[model samples]
Target: MTVSPAPREHDVLTDLLTQVGYRNEKAFAELYRRTSARLFGLCMRMMGDPDDAEETLQECFVVVWHRAPLFDPRLAGAMTWLMAIARNKAIDRLRQRPRTQGARDIDWDALPDTSPGPAEDGENDLAYRRLSDCLGALENRQRYCVRDAFFSGLTYVELAERMQVPLGTMKSWIRRALQQLRACMTP
Candidate 1:
């Protein structure tokens, strides 16, 4: 007896995205439910203010709804495409902000310390450096695939097509690269 493999998360997201492209409200709702928190976190990191992040997240969904029909799974994965939209929206918001010529004279002690403490910031910096090193250790193709998939927002199918490799092979390369990174990151 043959047992079928469980659907991967990207595959489920891909299906939901396709349904959303058909203007299915239920699919859009489900997609929002599944991805909003992740996208919100991304927005928060980019915008650096809760209010701005909230606004950016709202704008992102609006664009997502209007552009869902343009999503092509062959070109990018659902999450990748969604993230690209969110990133672009955040950038647009940033660009619209009025530039200040000089730092305003303000009492620094009056403001609350919303940012991370020095120790925490150091840890975060160290983690980033470690991750960069781990990525650099990957095979050239695997590194390229991972960067394209997560940074450039390319889908596995798109990566495969661009790299002239089978989809499964591209997936395997990324999976193994991630595994290696995980191992390297562990203390």
Candidate 2:
């Protein structure tokens, strides 16, 4: 099962972020305590290697520390915004290397060890379950493609080649898949 790192009740995180923006070390430490594992798992999945994931996670927080003052809650909730930074960091790390044909097909056999595993019932878990259900509604190819692309940071062209489809076809598939996800995710 897939899971996210942080929960969405981010009003407190927003307040903490405001403090971090002003260079409050305690708030930053608290932020890390709440979200680090989740972000580490995200980075691990994207990088597909534990070491790289750790590095990316650290870099993500460093950026967060510096950029907290620039955060705008009007744009997204705190965890959402923070995870975006983590995602971007992971993607950047992935893009730094040439795409290897071998890297395209990650073993989908089991969940990665780095993940926090199943979560307890709560807002984050509820949101997690909702996303899982939406993903479950997807066709196998669409579901796999979307998950693979996001987790692996593969470009559409790379995913197309890996899936043995044309680039446009892959793009269309992912786009439609994302649209379905949006519809499913809407409350």
Candidate 3:
């Protein structure tokens, strides 16, 4: 494979990002064309699996496309910010996968209930009630995704793989689910 030259530090990635915010696909592609290899390399190194690395690279690029305007050069230089995003995505992909044998069954009774004191307990109860009411309003699949993510600690990429759907579709379902939940819980 042909390697691209290193990205210039003074390049107007942020400017391209602003265009991306406005749904400029060409600009988005250009940004990806400039950055994908480096991000993919990081993903490959962090997540040893080739498939996982490719998926992480795609997810990172999608985020850059959708949320590029939010990038702040002052907090982190462009390469630094991009690499951090790539690293986080790779890590999340790595964690969703089980490295050992099948999941170990454990007794529920062995786990501690860390519910809070009286006042906090009351607040927790109220929050749980609100959450339940909100969750009840979601569509069946959306509810399932949220529950699996929250209770089982499954990340979106893992959820997508488990459900046999595209990552973008899974993200859309979860985003809509959260929006519905927020609308339900809002006073």
* Candidate 3 residue runs with Cα over 4 Å from true position: 1-9, 101-187
By lDDT, who's the top model here? 2
Q: What is the TM-score of each candidate against the true structure?
A: 0.55, 0.78, 0.47
- The pairs that clash in candidate 2 are 5-38
The candidate maximizing TM-score is: 2
How high a TM-score does candidate 3 get? 0.47
The alpha-carbon deviation from the true structure for residue 125 of candidate 2, after best TM-score superposition, in angstroms, is 5.0
Model 2 C-alpha lDDT per residue in residues 19-98, reported as the tens digit of each score:
99999999999888877888887787677789989999999999999999999988776777888899989888888876
Off by over 4 Å in 2: 1-12, 72-75, 101-104, 107-109, 112-126
Between prediction 2 and prediction 3, which has the larger lDDT?
2
Q: Model 2, residue 172: displacement in angstroms?
A: 0.7
Give per-residue CA lDDT, model 3, range 60-117, as digits (tens): 9887776777877676555556777887776676567765522222222344444233
Better of 1 and 2 by lDDT: 2
Arranged by TM-score, best first: 2, 1, 3
Error of 2 at 141 (Å): 0.6
- lDDT scores for all predictions? 0.75, 0.81, 0.69
Task: Judge candidate 3 against the unseen true structure and give its global Cα lDDT, from 0 to 1.
Answer: 0.69
Sorted by lDDT (best first), the order is 2, 1, 3
